[model samples]
Target: MIEIESVTKSYGDVRVLDDVSLTIPTGGITSLVGANGAGKSTLLSVAARLVPADGGRVRVDGMDVATAPGPVLARRLGVLRQENAMSVRLTVRELVAFGRFPHSGGRLTAEDHRLVDEAMAWFELGPLADRHLDQLSGGQRQRAYVAMVMCQGTDHVLLDEPLNNLDMRHAVQMMRMLRGMADELGRTVVLVVHDVNVASCYSDRIVAMREGRLVAEGPTAELMTPELLRKVFDVEVEVHELAGRRIGVPWS
Candidate 1:
């Protein structure tokens, strides 16, 4: 479980996360949703230790994230930030292989190679394995990055904007893959996403933030109401049931 205790952060005089406390249980997918500046991404970053919090603490699976050793924490938690950029050019296979560095220390063993191959095949990247990152489309690159994170073989995966540049089909595929990861592999998946409908459909729980404060959190079905969405996004939303799921439509 990920325990966030009254975490706070600030940028100059503006607060990005305001004493936000949340518990993300293990073995399922939880999505953070809100407007652009609602602190969803900031909260995720803090929990992943990509950014330090101004106050409070975060614990992952009973280990203090702030005090845990780098390699030890890396072994348990894997994170993928929104902007993935590399200064050096690398093939898709090389990028995926980098995920094993914590376990392999830059010298990949046979088991590492096997995991890399499995990750590439799982994401349907076998055809593009030899291609450089610059050579792939945005959606394909996003998938490759996610595959690298998954290849880390961690129990917890935290992703920021995982669906940023995908078309509808690939977006659906990505969510399905994440769902499979949680259901079959028993990994805890937490992501910052913009689309409420996507969160509604794929997430086991929904966390809503507004103005740097956590305003709502509950099971997917309970949090998908139009009132909660409007509270989070400050827009009129019409929520309807579609194919056994709740989908929200926003209006100006």
Candidate 2:
């Protein structure tokens, strides 16, 4: 579980996150939705301790994220930031194996090798395992990064725009794969998504942020109403029930 209390961040005079207090419980997928500058990504950064908060505190399952030992936190939480730019050339297998560094300390054991293989297979990267990152398409590269995060074997995973640069089919497949991770592995998954319909369909809970503060949060069913969508995205969207899911369509 991640406990965020009065979290705040600012760039110069512009505040990115303000007094944002949130509790992400264990073992489910939670999606954060809002406008581009709504502080969704900033909040995730603070919660993951990747960005320093000027005030308040964040704790993950009783461990203080800001003050805890680096290794201790790395073993418990895995984060995938939106900007993934690698300078060094590495094969997909090598990139995936990087996740095991926390456990293996740069020397992989047999168990580490097994987990890496499993992660590659799970993300369907077996065919491209030998290919370098530069050789893969954007979607394939994104999958490799995701596979790396999963190979970290952390209980909590925080991702910023996990669906970026994917086609419709791959996007749907990615969401389903995340759902499976939460249900089968009992891992906590928190991601920032722009598509409200996708969040409504795959997420157990939806967290809405706007103007540097969290405005709404609840189960997807309760959070998917037209009223809430308007409040968060500032767009008029019609909510419909289809195939046992609530999807929002923009006003035409």
Please list the C-alpha lDDT of all candidates, in the order they appear.
0.94, 0.93
Q: Determine which window of 10 residues in candidate 2 has minimal summed lDDT.
A: 172-181
Model 1 sits at a Cα RMSD from the real structure of 0.8
Q: What is the lDDT of residue 97 in candidate 2?
A: 99
Candidate 1 residue pairs in backbone clash: none
* Backbone steric clashes in candidate 1, count: 0
Residue pairs in clash, model 2: none
lDDT of 2 by residue, 1-252 (tens): 999999989999999988999999898999999999999998988888999899999999999899999888999999999989989999999999999988889999999999999999988999999999999999999999999999999999999999999999989888888998899999999999989888999999999999999999989999999899899988898999999999899865
Worst 10-residue stretch by lDDT in candidate 1?
243-252
Q: How close is candidate 1 to the true structure, as a TM-score?
A: 0.98
Model 2 RMSD vs true structure: 0.7
lDDT of 2 at 150: 93
Model 2: residues >4 Å from true position, as ranges?
none
Error of 1 at 219 (Å): 0.5
Q: How many residue pairs clash in each candidate?
A: 0, 0
- How well is each residue in 149-232 modelled by candidate 1, as lDDT tens digits? 999999999999999899999999999999999999999999999899999999999999999999999899999998888899
User: For candidate 2, what is the TM-score?
Assistant: 0.99
